[model samples]
Target chain A: MSAPLFEKIALVGIGLIGSSLARVIRRERLAGEIAIATRSPATLARAEELGLGDSYSTEAATAVANADLVIVSVPVGSSGAVAAEIAPALKPGAIVTDVGSTKRSVIAQMQPLLPGNVHFIPGHPLAGTEKSGPDAGFADLFENRWCIFTPLPDTDPQALERLSEFWRRCGANIDTMDADHHDMVLAIVSHLPHIIAYNIVGTADDLETVTKSEVIKYSASGFRDFTRLAASDPTMWRDVCLHNKDAILEMLARFSEDLASLQRAIRWGDGEKLFDMFTRTRAVRRSIIDAGQEIDVPDFGRQVVEHPGAVMPAAKS
Target chain B: MSAPLFEKIALVGIGLIGSSLARVIRRERLAGEIAIATRSPATLARAEELGLGDSYSTEAATAVANADLVIVSVPVGSSGAVAAEIAPALKPGAIVTDVGSTKRSVIAQMQPLLPGNVHFIPGHPLAGTEKSGPDAGFADLFENRWCIFTPLPDTDPQALERLSEFWRRCGANIDTMDADHHDMVLAIVSHLPHIIAYNIVGTADDLETVTKSEVIKYSASGFRDFTRLAASDPTMWRDVCLHNKDAILEMLARFSEDLASLQRAIRWGDGEKLFDMFTRTRAVRRSIIDAGQEIDVPDFGRQVVEHPGAVMPAAKS
Candidate 1:
């Protein structure tokens, strides 16, 4: 590359999102030097062992000093703390951003702390697996994903475009919406799914008649799909639920009401109503697959061997 | 291979499960001849085109005339009608079984119609993908999966052994339980998950504030996993809910109660409660992955290269 995008980039709280950003940035030569920082000393040591950055520090202020860009990638609840820590050390023209899931609360928490000289654009990458930690991240985590920016009204256009280009280089498509709309949209799309998955798995776990082993053995029937979402980082999800309370509660209320209606249809033996809802939902999945939002890998095992073989794979797990 | 397990096998209802069973039977040399039948002429034609069986017919009686094994794979609501049509033609020693998701209802609907001369073992293979129809089937769908049998009190031991042997040959582990117990177990494991998935997807579809396109585009953010389970055949699920009403309603009520508590936790900003629930649920996914009951495929796009590359891929879908 002729020159790196920034002379130095400071990453705060190097967890899954943070480390993934580091990998993509290094892969694309997006920064001349990478500075990593986290609250935990053990995590900072792990980042160093992973060769994640050009410099490692346990102190956020030490990491952000003289850096052109600072990205806070901790849980949403920690946004304000990091912003306050790095505010005095931020360079005059540095652009400060975050990769939190909830936008409105993050904006409310962090905006008041950052100085007027820096651009504080709240963002969320509509990406990630349920797995977490530094090891769980990879350079392509954001590939073909959406990164939504909820820029405050006073945000600098040039700074916003610059951040957008950075995410684009990191293999994500970018969009912009206000903080409130972002929270509402995400409550239905992301928050509700995780809550439902966690709830169902917990319910299954607590069943006295149906042993836990039984649930685990027959999970592939339908229960296993929810488990993946339920296995997400607990701390991150707790923060999202706490920060986006109103929007999530709104979505959960609607979800519970819809489920009540479905339960009534089943109790009353209304096959027509049940069939209609199930049929309508199938169309949405088709649209998601058609929109290229899903992998469409075919959940069942692939039948290989064109001519002849055992229907089952030869090797058992 | 060793003198086919049975002289001939007849499959009624050539959908995903039926086609998959036919493929597995042929691969394992479990039958000398295969006969397929369905109420829909188009489905029978498609099954014939796919070479799913040696013979095809629209009449269930004709298909089961000389068959040693008769598998009814139709929707649960149609179980009684199929049993009535084939009861007269079933061979004296033939084993008649079903693969319906609900056990008690299938037994109740089919048992009285059939003669005591033939064995009626109600069975369900805990396997399937969301897609339906003959074209969507693969032989390996039931590999390492559970095939549960709900046998009547007077069912012949030899007939049960023969059918169990056939399922083992098809690469499934088998277990037997009473019909009522099977229904209750399945209501929590299979029926509830599908209902919740269908309900959430329906809620998303009916939302006026959040556009459908937005949900579809950002579905990789966790919602797409639910969509896979929700997209299952509508006719099949409608029958399941109607047939397993009491058990399903019980599980749904428990699920709703757990969800309401979770909603309150989020509303009251009880991060500790949220964290505890989210953490406990993660262990269940671990058990599922360990039990070899699920393929723990990571959800996001994999990181293909480690070094460096352009943000955009060469191929665009």
Candidate 2:
């Protein structure tokens, strides 16, 4: 479609994010040679079977050899190890980046290990579904999604712009911020939501009076919405909770305090208070839709989209 | 197409659920005549514009004067008033039902006010979108969703069966349980989720560090899932919290306790513990999908379905 942006690009950790990158890079002709690497032999074989990349390897070092760009897509906890493995093999001018949820931890884990000759950038693409693994990825996974880059103070502007261009080509809008600010923003918007979802699901599962069958059967009322976030990859979330500890803890405390106030309002039968709180949160959803971050239809338009012609719109008189 | 189930059916409160009932009743030819009633003249006029009913009235008594079936779809707090208004005009052998989230309170509010000759069955069709009002309704809102009826001990079997048949024709499966058990079950499955969602969004909104712009920009990461529930009808949710106070308090207590333990796990960096909790919750989602209560596609298949041909599924070798 267009000239390849790089002579070669290596993708480490061929999970949902990595596999999606491979698909997009291939479709857009972003790389002349796409190399994919993962620790799991089965996953590597599966990637090769799907023809996701020009070369597949179980070793990260072998995959990144002579690569003009190296993108690591793994759990936050494994960032350091992958950085150590690929550091020596990376080309001098290669741009290295990551797709971990937490940016500060990723930077701390990989910055020192990466060779000084290469430009290292910590990034998080705020996009994914509950599903995981190589097969779960699709080429349009990052379409219209925000991919935030928390670059180092001494980071090369030219290299940063190049990587931004690369992500823009993959159908992502780019935003840059400080690593600490990125963690705080994500704590409220991403980490805390996932934690709350997992906690609620666990609570529902552990209930003695309410049968599990009943919970599942009647989930459409509201509980099913939380289940989607709770079903995300356990290993990935564990790393996130561990890596972004300070910001996540701060958010949890604030959330618990707010819950206490809400609980008290309910106990006192403060209908006005409850109604006020419930009414204000609605404007945020409206803002998100207006900003194009969310779908504009009701219930994410699942009912209408899932079964076309099943739901007829209101009649015109 | 089929024999009319009722000679005249009166729908009180022409909002999301009521309007949906109107659409489905007309589509399935379930009612010979559909009369719509609401306290709000604007909503009644809108329903009339949409041709959702054969006749429209502002007074519940006028709408149900000779109707064989009357369905009240209003906030739980208004159930008693509606019951009082329509008690004198209810037909001798009519069946009356209300679709409210809190069943025990609805029974307490309306059971004594309703006329003795009429069969009053307190029902809750566990179906809705975040959006409300008559214009938001579609014919398939109840399709494949559950409709739980908490009938009184002296409820007539024929009345219950006829009402269940009406719901089945509207494409909902029927379940019956004691009013108390229904409250407890719904506290966990529905009320708590909405309360927690509302609380978290409130927390995010109240934050001083993270800008509102940042939260909306990054909402797709996970926060947007909670926003859908938080954006629900405030008056309806407030009424639910007030009416189902005891059961909701119990569930909220359990949710907070569970959340505290999860916070501790994250603070202590217990990856194994965090991983286990996150992994177990995934099964609940799977069971929900298997039970036919939820869609099987990822992210409710929003991205794929919204932009058909935008996403190419993983290549098959």
Candidate 3:
């Protein structure tokens, strides 16, 4: 293996993303020493028990001391608080980054709190499972996913390159965009979908005529797909919505408008309109596949591998 | 391995579900002879070229003649017409079934046209990919999926058992439910999801600020999942919406109400409410995973895999 990417790395908030990073860093020897910290004492204890770091602490300032690199993987709402806690202890010229889903809000929240000497680049790794917590992480979680960075105007180029290199070794392709652009892109791609999913699942749950058990049993249709996204970390997504308010609301308004039109088409029995919209949307799936952003499961067997707790009897071959 | 389940089995359509059933029946030797018929001459010719049937015909009446089982796999709108066409030729005591997604509509449309002598059993296999056409099917599509049969009152128990046996041979577990109940269940489980997916994809497609390429490029987050369901056969889905209007409208109303509430929560910055709703939805996904309906991709790789053409590349591992 090549030499470690950083002499010492500090991780704030060792949840699914943080723990996964720890595992990958350990597996690939990406860090000489790993220091882990989380706001929750119980989570910190769990991380210690899992041996996810060389040192464990509840104090973010202590964790960042002497660290060459620091990653904040908490909910977007907590980025500022963590940055404030670690700002004083951050070593001069240390590269600092975050893995929040929304970029502009995170940058706004963290930039003012961080020391001027350190690189405070905001990023989002376009990857995650529905499961959270320290135990719900794996080494390959970042493999083949996109990691987008939104650096500030005065951000050091050398620091940005080093952070990009770190993500590259973590099995991601790097893309850089302005914070607002990233927020808008993610609002359409990620936020809106999750919001829609949460809405639909809640709808099904609130049904009086159709029982929940029936929905669960017959979910093989299309509902099951949305459930996976709907099941994402509640705290993180809640913060995302609150933090990226304008972009999400804009996308939601657009989505609601389009949905009203579709509802009209269905109500009016306009087959051609429905068919055209359905046909056009299919090409996007093909493009995503070509980009290598997902796996092809001929059957449900492959799904169990990615979610170990999701084991089911194999279909009789 | 076992005696052919039927001396002759006629398939009245050759689309995705129809062709998949034909392939499985052929592979399992569940029929001594397979006769395929569809409204379109081009599709009929293609099925013959693909060797999806032992005999091919354009006329539904001719195809059902002397057949012990006739499986009508046409769109729901055409169910009554096909039943009318084949009623006179259906052999005495023969089991007539369908693979329509909306059971109540299929039953309502077909029952009146069929002769009392023929056993008209409406069934639906809860298995399909987004792709359509005879070329999109495979022999193992039905394996481990549920095939629901909605039998009318006074329907022959022996015929029902025999049809269930046929589905079992095709590698599906048999489920029996009333047509109305099945329609309501599917409205929530299958129909609404597809409608929502189609609506959202249309919404993304019509965005003025976000380019289509940008949506496709970053779809790995959540939008790609919706595209898979939206990419389903337009004609089939359109027919389903028209035929199963009441149930779908009911579900849509409930969905819209729930969405309004979620929108209110987001607008008011009600983090607790958002967090609770998001948290509750997570368990349903777990139930779906427990029921073996979906695969769980880690933090980054959660793309839909229903259409072969839409299979995204697996993230770099």
Best by lDDT: 2
By summed lDDT, which 10 consecutive residues of candidate 2 chain A come out lowest? A308-317
Winner on lDDT between 1 and 2 is 2
lDDT of 3 at B264: 81
Instruction: Give the CAPRI class of candidate 2.
Output: medium
Residue A300, candidate 3: C-alpha displacement in angstroms:
7.0
Write candidate 3's Cα lDDT for B232-257 as tens digits.
88788888888787888888878887
Alpha-carbon interface RMSD for all candidates, in angstroms? 5.5, 6.9, 3.8
For residue B82, model 2's alpha carbon misses the true position, in angstroms, by 0.7
Q: Distance from true position, residue B8, model 2, in Å?
A: 0.7
List per-prediction Cα lDDT, in the order shown.
0.88, 0.91, 0.84
Worst-scoring 10-residue span by lDDT in model 3 chain A: A297-306
| Per-residue lDDT of A34 in model 3 | 100
List the lowest-lDDT window of 10 residues for candidate 1 chain B. Answer: B303-312
Query: Over the stretch A12-116, how does candidate 1's per-residue lDDT look in tens digits?
Result: 988889999999999999999999999898988999999999999999999999999999999999988998899999999999999999998999899998899
List DockQ, one per candidate, in order.
0.54, 0.50, 0.54
Superposed on the true chain A, the predicted chain A of model 2 yields a TM-score of 0.96
Question: Model 2 over residues A30-104: C-alpha lDDT tens digits?
Answer: 999999999999999999999999998899999999999999999999999999999889889999999999999
Model 1, range B1-317, lDDT digits (tens) per residue? 36999999999999999999999999989999999999899999999999999999999999999999999999999999999999999999899999999998898899999998898999999988898999877788888889999988898899999999999888888988888888888988899999999999998998998999889888889888899889999999999999999999999989999999999899888899999999999999888877777545456222222212212233222
Q: In lDDT terms, how accurate is model 2?
A: 0.91
CAPRI verdict (incorrect, acceptable, medium, high) for model 1: medium
